[model samples]
Target: MSTKIKANTDAFIKARVVKGYSQRELARHSGLSHAYVSLLERAIKSVGPSTAKKLSDLLDKELEELFRIEMQPRP
Candidate 1:
């Protein structure tokens, strides 16, 4: 997978885990399906911009932080 994709996946998983939330719990909080969450974690699907925003809102993080491209520098 590309570095950006890997970074997004890693960030998503790490954020959720750090919050002590399971996939199911994150799905519930984010209003995304558990299967969709699974697909996201596995990098089988790309998360849409709106969905990423929702996840950021749910996780109380900046949307940019969630979907950043690794090693590209952050503003």
Candidate 2:
């Protein structure tokens, strides 16, 4: 099983900015790599459940507000 997170880019960036967290800062506080944070913000990469929750919590936003999560089964 694979889960993909499609982030609401505008909301994600806005929330982070509103919270005064830069990409690197957010990543550091979230215990995620800065590269991954950059990729996620650019929609170049997707995150799993735990990572998604971490970001949402750290950003002080609802999970559904920042991301559209989908679960897909690999063939």
Candidate number with greatest TM-score: 2
lDDT of 1 by residue, 1-75 (tens): 333432267877888898889999999988889998898877676666678778888877788776754334455
Say which candidate scores most in lDDT: 2
lDDT of 2 by residue, 1-75 (tens): 877897788999999999999999998999989998888888788988888998999998999999987789999
CA lDDT of every candidate: 0.75, 0.90
Q: In model 1, how many backbone clashes occur? A: 0
Q: Which stretches of candidate 1 lie over 4 Å from their true place?
A: 1-7, 68-75
True-structure RMSD, every candidate: 6.2, 1.7
